[model samples]
Target: MWMGEGFVSEIQHNRGREDTMDDVGHRYLRELVQRCMVLVGKMGSLGKIKTCRMHDLMRDFCVSKAQEENFLHINNILSLKLCEVQNNKVRRLAVILESDENYIEGVKFNEYPYLSYRVCCKLELGNLNYLQTLVNVRPKTIQIPTWFKFNLLQVLKVRNKKGAQDAIQMLISRCPLIEKLHLYGHLKKLPEAHQFSPNLAKLTLSGTKLEEDPMETLKKLPNLKILCFRQAFEKISKYESVGRASFNGKNMVCSKGGFPLLQYLFLGTLYYLEEWRVEEGAMPSLCRLEIEFCSRLKMIPDGLRFIATLQELKIIDMPKPFIDSLNEGGPDFDKVKHVHSLVLKSFCQRMIIVSS
Candidate 1:
């Protein structure tokens, strides 16, 4: 999200540097952690912070300062009217929706789990050419203007856009610099992966019941580095959505040359995934892998056994039989023996099998 907003992305790092925008973003985050601006909420397989939380005092101060400077704005449609934004100029905006307009005005902030505050927005996004990040805006609320040209937008997030496939595609086409996209809604169709922004590096989708195999399509994305899917392919009743927990299986195959610069992969809560194949050279730069609650997956892919770059593997909420198979001398044990750190988590127990 920081990268998309050009927070750390546009930094003219060292001349002729090889670091990616995503790498620069992480390096900035690490600096924040060192400064104690936020607290780590969750950790990934490779010990990177997957989520973070800010203290109430810090959060409020930042929000107040940002709004005062017109540097950031929060358009909470439930209580605050869109037309009432302090200033017309904002570099980044977060559009929050709450169907019920009546609510307690908490001293700090309120959380509205239900969405949809529509049509009254009237804010012309087409005029906000300086905008860099537009997050959590519902298509039903603010229709993307036909003349929209957000050349500086780098991060876009949309929620509960049930039937706005064409509008979503059109909106994406207008944001030439968009790099991170997150879609959360029950979607029946998906835009062609090839049509995605070529500069896109991070993508996340949730609750999308795509009729087409998403992997087969997404594998075509040229610059994708980080990908995540939650409850998109798995049986909804068997597994609930886990934020930022990436892949949920649906007949996925990692073909050769797919996600060439990818470093992190995650699979979670896929109930019927019985097999997964990874061809040689697929995700060749992958360093961290995580598989969680994929109850029916029978064995680890044979290709993992040969991915010399793989560094960490974490398995969570898996069946006992699956855990046994990765133990010493077990059928699939050798496949993961080379991993530097191997950890597994079950409902009642957590254990580390190996560490380097």
Candidate 2:
């Protein structure tokens, strides 16, 4: 259990569903802490709790309750003994590994279920059928099991170590109900628009290299609400392309009506990005925009002014000139003056504002 900040509420809103924590998400978590049912963990820069851990007693209590209610099963892959009786009636299974020596050698998955693997183990997935959620901790590529069915899968988070773009695309193509996907590691190329998941709501690409303009393809994701690129998107040239030679005069443009439902966008550590253009009507629903460590980027997209729904804009560790241009009476001030909250941060200082 963890303090979701606004993440939980945001997910509910993005899915067009009422928030389960509508009236008291934080209050509920706070009450749990007050009752000693949960232990608080990490805190964010804002001094708000970001994560929460459970005490051993609380954990045991939860596990017992879950088993009694037929809510879920927690399996320890590393400590399983022949004397233990596995519960086959549980519909949700969370597999955890206690050590590197443990392997997924004999886990059965014939029932329609939700499976979460909390370890970086190399396991064959062909025998699993009717899985709803899967989180593979390892970045290694595994062959798709022949008995695997993707139609029922809704959430997938995995890392591809071999830069297997094709393999990822093939998996995505088969999952019609897929909603959230997080892909980590190098990706030489992204899949074409036709192969995109129609219901995909959130997407994250971390530590990947895009051979072409990522926006050109990502913009077509009809229901995408959250888009993030972390240390992703690098310049590829036949020769060394750093500094002046890297993306010398390149630009990325977001076309009109693109990312129709996007609410948040984050671009970080894009070392070679020098220019980004946003066309009017693009990201019409965008509520927050953040750019970080993109030293070469010189300006904020002028078209951002047209996004009436935008409420926040943040620039961190960017070039000094870029931040200066967003200051009051600066060249681009008028373009972003309408945003309710604007924050600009340089190496040693930060400026925050609330528009009139």
Most TM-score-accurate candidate: 2
How high is each candidate's TM-score? 0.67, 0.71
TM-score of 1: 0.67
Runs in model 2 deviating more than 4 A are 1-78, 82-96, 99-106, 116-122, 137-141, 145-148, 232-249, 350-356
Q: How far is candidate 2 from the true structure (C-alpha RMSD, Å)?
A: 7.9
Q: Which pairs clash inside model 2? A: 126-145
Q: Candidate 2's residue-wise lDDT over 1-356, tens digit each?
A: 12123333432442555554422456667778899888889863223456899989889888899899987768776555423334544446666677665445545444434555443445556655556677763434455754455776767886665556667777777678787887776666777877878998888877766657788898999989888877633346766433211112257789998999999999877777878999998999999999988887878999999999989888888777788888898999989988888888876565544344
The superposed Cα distance between candidate 2 and the true structure at residue 26, in angstroms, equals 17
| CA lDDT of every candidate | 0.69, 0.71
Model 1: how far is 171 from its true place, Å?
Answer: 2.2
**lDDT top scorer:** 2
lDDT (Cα, tens digit) per residue for candidate 1, span 163-280: 8777676767787877888877656666777567888888877665555557677778787777766654333366663332233345668888787877777776655577889988
